[model samples]
Target: MQPHEKVKQYLDTICEQIRYKRIHNELREELENHITDQKQAYIAQGMDEETGTFKAVEQMGDPVMVGTQLDRTHKPKPEWSMIVLTLLLLLTGTFIRLYTAPRETNGLELFYRQLLFTVVGIGLMTLCYKVDFTILGEYSSILFFALAAIIVLLMLVINPVDGRFIYASYPLLLFPALFAGVVYSMSNRGYSGVILCGIYFTIPLILSLLIPNITITLFLTLSYLVILTIAIQKKRFKVNQHHALLLVYVPFIISFVVAMTNNNLIYRLKIVFTPSLAPMGVGYMGNITRGIMKGARLIGQGALPENLQGLTVEQVLPLINSDFLLTYITHRFGWIAFLIVVALLELFIIRAFVLCARQKSVLALLVSTAVTLTFAYQTLGFVVTNCGFYLFAPLSLPLISQSSHYLLVNMSLIGILLSVYRTGHMVHDKRFPEKPDRRPFLTIEDGRIIIDLHLD
Candidate 1:
């Protein structure tokens, strides 16, 4: 039989048993190329054509086994480590609420609500994992504009409840998705890619400023810097240091200048930098928080500290269930619990970075890395603010905080990250053609085919 006919027969047998038909053509092309190369080597060594083809086929091992092995390698699998860590964090948040629930406030009720949110978040995450993340890349422009419009509407229409502005959590939550799309769309474009990214970034920046939520604005700005840096590092965009610095610092300078004019912001800055100068009425919370943290020491006050048990939420610490939850944890459960929470957060962020490194597609890499930075920055901000380093933002810890919007947004981002991880290595024939096998298992040396069976 001809070499081509024999190869086709073998491929047909292998593909027949393979479960995933989508990869059948790719696997066939790879095997054919390897077999063809092997046959050519045997012919060069003076073997007859028919014998060369037969020998090449013989060396490929069993078709069924090869096909099954390829299927297993390409199968989609969840990152269970991430899922478990997320659940653990969610449980910890529940424990904190139960332990610190004031007599007037229903602790059990809050825990049930948090549990419901966790269940919903996990379901959404699973859906994201199963779907093709690259599809988001295709519709990035539409998604960005839609999200941008939502932010604008929220800014104009939503009235502040209790004199506090509502955060743009929906827009911020969807930022990574919109970002992944933008990055994918501009992947091969040169300088234009950077320009397009900058334009996409402006929408959130403007909306956050309009809401006068400096915290969200700062978060968005930092996210933009991270995305830009990753793009430059990946060689997707070429940017000089001067231009990169301008891209980063220019907006920040402008924002800082604009923020200085607001009296409320000026007061927050005083609380952060010069607490002694802060007004006695409003800035007293910083002092109270410091006292609470100091009283906790190495071990916390043991679930319900006698000193803090009877105090109401307003009297104990403002925003205890949301922004001040970590502080409350330290005050009630002690530094050890705080450290445990921080440790878990570090693991989550590190895992994200590891996943980002493993991504083969540039768009996935950008999206995953952006998600990692978003979490990292928020965690840092939360910790810093709790430690009394900065008093300007009410940034919540990713999964440990009790805000419904914050929890849902962060969980959705985690879902997108998992999606990117699952689809990172997928390759399509149109975009990435199969290359000649160069795995170093076999080589043509001195006009002869040499197979190195020894594992390195």
Candidate 2:
């Protein structure tokens, strides 16, 4: 066979063993280039064409061995660290609930219920991780419109029972679907992309206003903004400063001003700015929360207080099992335990952001960032509210909160993140081959080939 034919045969052998087809092609191209270079050098040293090709091919080592190594390097693996951290957080939450919950309050029943939710969440997460998240991009429009319709229908049909809307929690579950839409739209370039994003953004915004669930509105708005920012940075969508000012900044300012006049919003703000103004009314819960933290002091009471005897932490602190769970944890477990929880949560957030930054696919990056930002903003809202910093709407801490809806949604998102991590380096669009790595694994030095073999 000719030198080129021999080179092709060698590459074909290796490509057969590579599981990832894209990587297989990439490896073929790279190896062919390296061998050609080596063959040229051998010819320059006065070797015949056939001899040079043979030497070049021989230097590549066994094709099977090379293929196996590449397969191992390129294989998609589960993000075990993320899974372990999630399990740890779940265990911590379970322990906290079991330890601090009052025996008279059906604590055992709550634990069993939470355990059941945890099991379901884990199963859902594993399924999500194993599935190709990119497929969500394919049905983004359908998902977005369906979710919007559900929210609208719920808002119109469901009445407030027990002084709270029955379907209020449903919007929180809309995020992953909305994020998929953002990824789909942003991946489409030009003005069309922006229009698609605007349509998706308006759906939840209008629904939130109609339902008058300002908290969901805020979360959706912030998440959309993050998606938009990433889109702009990646040049998937374009907007000038003037457009941004008018379209984004001005609207945000107007909303803030309008929110100040809202009675429900104003009442929450009042509790934050001047708790003394309505100590027995709107601010009552805030005061009780503050009192619990203060009463706990540094090391905590080690048990329920005499005044609080026979009462669960949930009884004393409103929304203790959901929104105020962190506060209750701080009160019952002291500052040290609170710090540990905070550290774990922070680590989770940071790792997620890191995953987002490392993603090569625009869809994966946007999805990862959206999920991370959701967790981050929710955590900030809850922590700030717990610390008496603001009168923000209550949001459950991800993974740690006892709210079943939040638990399922948060775990599903974590699974999506893991999916993104596994496929982050993949190039989805054939038109855009991934940029060649400037820092190659194989390089020639002092007339000798050096294989770094270090996967970054």
Give Cα-based local distance difference scores for all models. 0.71, 0.70
Per-model tally of clashing residue pairs: 2, 0
TM per candidate: 0.75, 0.75
The residue pairs in collision within model 2 are none
Candidate 2: global Cα-lDDT?
0.70
What is the Cα-based TM-score of model 2? 0.75
Error of 1 at 94 (Å): 1.5
The residue-by-residue lDDT of candidate 2 on 1-456, one tens digit each, is 334888888998888887866557667767888998999999999999899999999999999899888888888867777778888988887877666554325656666787888899899888888776775665677767777777667766888676555475555555644565455555534444554566667777776666666667788888777777666667554434234333444566787899778998766776776665676777766666666666564666434446667886666776566667777778766877778888999998898788788788777787778878878877788777776554656667777766676787787878878887876676453233233334533457999976442345
Superposed model 1: Cα runs more than 4 Å off: 1-66, 102-108, 149-168, 238-267, 279-282, 302-314, 425-456
| Local accuracy of candidate 1 as per-residue lDDT tens digits, 1-456 | 343788889999888877656567788888888998998999999998789989999999998888778778777666788878888888877777666554225555666777788788877766766666766776788878888878776656777665545755445656755675686676544444556688888887777766667777777877777777776666554434445445556766887789789998776777776554553555555655665676676884733334556664347676677677778778766899889999999999999898888877777787788778878988998987776555666767888876666777788788888877765676441242222223433457899986543333
- Ten residues in sequence with the least summed lDDT for candidate 1: 429-438
Query: lDDT score, residue 90, model 2?
Result: 86
Give lDDT: candidate 1, residue 178: 67
Candidate 2: which stretches are off by over 4 Å?
Answer: 1-16, 20-70, 102-106, 149-160, 163-168, 174-177, 180-184, 210-212, 238-246, 261-267, 302-315, 389-393, 428-456
